[model samples]
Target: MFNLIKNEWIKIFSRPGTYVMIGLLVLLVIGAGSVMKFAGVSQEPEGDWKQQTQMQIESDKQYLEEMGGSENFQTQYYKQQVAINEYRLANDIEPASGESIWSFVNFNSNFVEIIGLFAIIVAAGIVASEFTWGTIKLLLIRPISRTKILLSKYITVLLFGITLLLTLFLLSTLVGAIFFGGGDGQPHLVYIDGAVEEQNMVFYLIKTYLLKSISITMMATMAFMISAVFRSSSLAIGISLFLLFMGGTATQFISMKYDWAKYSLFANTDLTIYTGAMQPLVDDMTLGFSVTMLIIYFVIFHLLAFIVFKKRDVAA
Candidate 1:
């Protein structure tokens, strides 16, 4: 398995396109940092944070009153905001102020989507390309079982994805530190079950990045499955990329009128919804439920890929 994975990794990095994708990711992070540094995007507000907090509390209260009796997601959002802001005032914990390394890292979290895009591209092509280039015959001619080969390829794809994520995190941190100061040691305040909790900023950022990767991981796995089942990288990439961009929006639209939408892959992909950051699409969806759903989907995708690949006729 180690040798197989190593071979697969070598194959992935051997291509110029792989380097291009990585180069693009690096350039994007640096470009974004440069833009924010030069555009005078101040992370700090001018007035007293206490005064600003009070103003925000007042605004939220007014909005809540205006939205009374209409209990929906927006109402819940305002209520969460009100609770968090009030907690900030009561605890005298000032909101994050001034650009810092942590702040820049948080900002760069948006680039996770780009990482997912590149991963999906790689996953979608990895298996299908073997067949496309008529290398599957040579690959299967080895003494290794088909399952091991497929697993090795899948593991390699995962390793590649992890490499991209780490590059993003580390590169963002470097650029952030260079452009912004080290950090101000601010605690990340999170609202949970009607209470605000203070968490280590670094730990919170790392957790945030991991949570955000769930959707991408699923999409990449699905792409890999498609690639294995159908010997066409173009088709696999097309479907995966399309859903990667539009699946969540379409799922949200359906969720507005249908509670069953909660069972959707896209709906549950965002585990952050369970963190009280926002309301779930369905009122009853919980973290446990989403995790279970993801596990089911994960198993199903792998089962389809492995079963098909093992039984597939390569003699043609």
Candidate 2:
């Protein structure tokens, strides 16, 4: 299996599109950083832009106490007061400001949308590339099992996800160093109470990207399975891409209107969203829980890919 994996690696690396995707990811990270760098948008690392505002609120309340409640602004506290209550209800932890880059890139991740979109491209490209150049026959004729071939392809595709993310992180760090200047790698999630919860940005970024990678892996597995079943890589990719976007909307709708959303693969689309937009998890649902679901989904698709590929006839 290892050798099979290696052989799959060679074939995958040999493709030009693989490197192209890596290059694109490099550009994306650099581009985003460049935008941040050039725009003069230094976000408060304490999560959310209004860390100072939260601080001010605390100060105001303290002042009010000292003044014997002589002055009070209902407007200021009322707006955030409900949010505070909900934060406490949803998470035992007090609502923090967010992250160092919340103001700039907090909602930008939309992991499900990003990873789902990425998966379609990578997944379709995996088998589409083989069939595009008419080399799929050579692929199947090898001594390796068809199931192993698909697994190898899946691995190679996943490596692409890792490489792309690594490039983005490295480029971001470099850009941040060169353009934004060096800052602490430690990421802190600030609460509404003005207390900061520290998270290693590097580690958090790694874990977040891995979650994204897993999402992409599920996508790749699904696409590969489609390719095996359809035997038309282009059709497989096209179909998968179509389904990705559609599944996202459909799944969200189902989650809202029906009670079966949790059962759907698309239901667990966004890891960030699953964590309540990084708000925090109070119930059984968590980033870890979402990842487990993803793993189960990946395994199911993986098995299906192997089963179909092993049994399918080669027509091309």
lDDT for every model? 0.90, 0.58
RMSD of each: 1.1, 7.9
Candidate no. 2 TM-score: 0.69
TM-score of 1: 0.97
Residue-wise C-alpha lDDT for candidate 1, range 1-316, written one tens digit per residue? 9999999999999999999999999999899888889985576788799999999999999999998778787898888988989988998888877778898899898899888999999999999999988899999999999999999999999899899999999999999999987987767877777777888989888888899888779999999999999978899889999999999999999998999999899999988776667888888888999999999999999999999999999897
Looking at model 2, residue 273 earns an lDDT score of 46
Encode model 2's per-residue lDDT on 21-79: one tens digit a residue: 66665566567766766765444456543554566556655655566743223333443
Consecutive 10-residue window with the lowest summed lDDT within model 1: 39-48
| Backbone steric clashes in candidate 1, count | 0
Q: Please give each candidate's TM-score.
A: 0.97, 0.69
